[model samples]
Target: MVKYNCYKPKTEIICSGSSEDVVGQYYQDVGRSDSQGDVDITIGEALQATALTSGEKPVEWSDAAAIHEAEVRATGRKTIMPDGITAAAQSAATRNARTTRDEDKTKLGEVLSNASTKLASDKGATRGDAESVMSVEKRDDPNFTTHPAGVATSIAAAVRLNRRQRPG
Candidate 1:
């Protein structure tokens, strides 16, 4: 049996008794590396990871509005506002949220790319080498996004929340 350590940090050791097992694990790790480098995680995964890492879920614009409404109601104020004003407020909030989410996604993508490059450096490859490999891999993968803004918005949003929650 061949035993090897996976490159992922904090991961358990892998043991393979056959060549096929080793190859399968290698491909799986590669796929995971690609996902991490692209900051591609599902909403559920993002939420879980964020909660684990930062102790809280990121609040979206809708959540903020809901909280505000609840607080206003708690003060014994009428919850009913003018329909046009409410609509306008909701529209603006949505637009601002979208803008912030898009920006955060971009930042997270950059962070992931940098992290991949750093990993390559740790393995004796230069930044340029890592970038070249990423370029080829992205080109080969039709579904890969260069910026990946929408693809990893949840993860990015979580990162933003963590930052905001951190004490100065």
Candidate 2:
């Protein structure tokens, strides 16, 4: 997140009399004594300088924090850092993560494509053959069913089954 000084035209009632009234307006620069318009905006908005367009993705806070840490390590001068530096780092981190995820997805797609091609080649393969191929893949890749969410889901199911089997 970022803090921005939001300023609007300051208005004043110059005169308040029975016969006539006068008004004045002027724009106040940021950090002026009478300008007290501060707003908090998300990092994405600060970096983009506008609302997200269609199909545009926003930066995640975790990515920003990671980028900030990396910049601090690289520069060795952490204090009084400019917002531009933070914004640029955050943008870079987001792009890097996106690129990495896309690459991983492509790899997974290729694996799936190869698996399907193999299955299609076996024109008379039975359902058991498909199961055998899946078991082999799972055995080869330890991470195949070890995702955090998958582990948690299996744990929850086990707990539920244990409770159902408990003695009354």
Candidate 3:
């Protein structure tokens, strides 16, 4: 809400706009006033009655108090976001997503590493037998990289190794 002097009859108009085009003198000044007559609407309903037929800053009226109340109502907003960031400082969604992705990748790596170690060190197979089976399975079978497939391949290779070492 503001008071400004207008040109036609030296009357007053109340609105938000530039300080320059104000007809004569105002009780106070805010933004510069140009001949645009276009007032930036802070809200919709407050000025419905005051809207002018035409002119620079047509959204004006003689009543400054009504404009003041309207400004308060129109500009009011709730503070939903956390305080540390201003509107200009807002960031993208990717950083949080990247962090979660990295964590999942680490957990997956640990799971696969544990599975491989367990298969290689299992009771019946020698390390060489386990390594050979794992290598061959990885090369020949599409499912070879899976934990269950590694154990199965290692078991089969150990059985073959055991059979070869026995007396014919």
Best by lDDT: 1
lDDT of 1 by residue, 30-149 (tens): 232232243322222332332244222233333224322321222223343333222333454455556745443222222122222222112212233324333433443346532232
- Comparing candidate 1 with candidate 3, which one achieves the higher lDDT? 1
Stretches of candidate 1 exceeding 4 Å from the true structure:
7-105, 108-110, 113-122, 126-128, 137-168
| lDDT tens digits by residue: candidate 2, 138-160 | 44333653222221122233334
Relative to the unseen true structure, what is the C-alpha lDDT of residue 50 in candidate 2, on a scale of 0 to 100? 15
**What TM-score does candidate 2 reach?**
0.20
lDDT tens per residue, model 3, 1-80: 56644322213457565575544434332321224442321122112212221111211111122222222222222231
RMSD of 3: 35.7
Evaluated at residue 115, the lDDT of candidate 3 is 24
Pairs of residues at least 3 apart in sequence or in different chains that clash in candidate 2: none
lDDT (Cα atoms) of all candidates against the true structure: 0.33, 0.29, 0.29
Ten residues in sequence with the least summed lDDT for candidate 1: 117-126
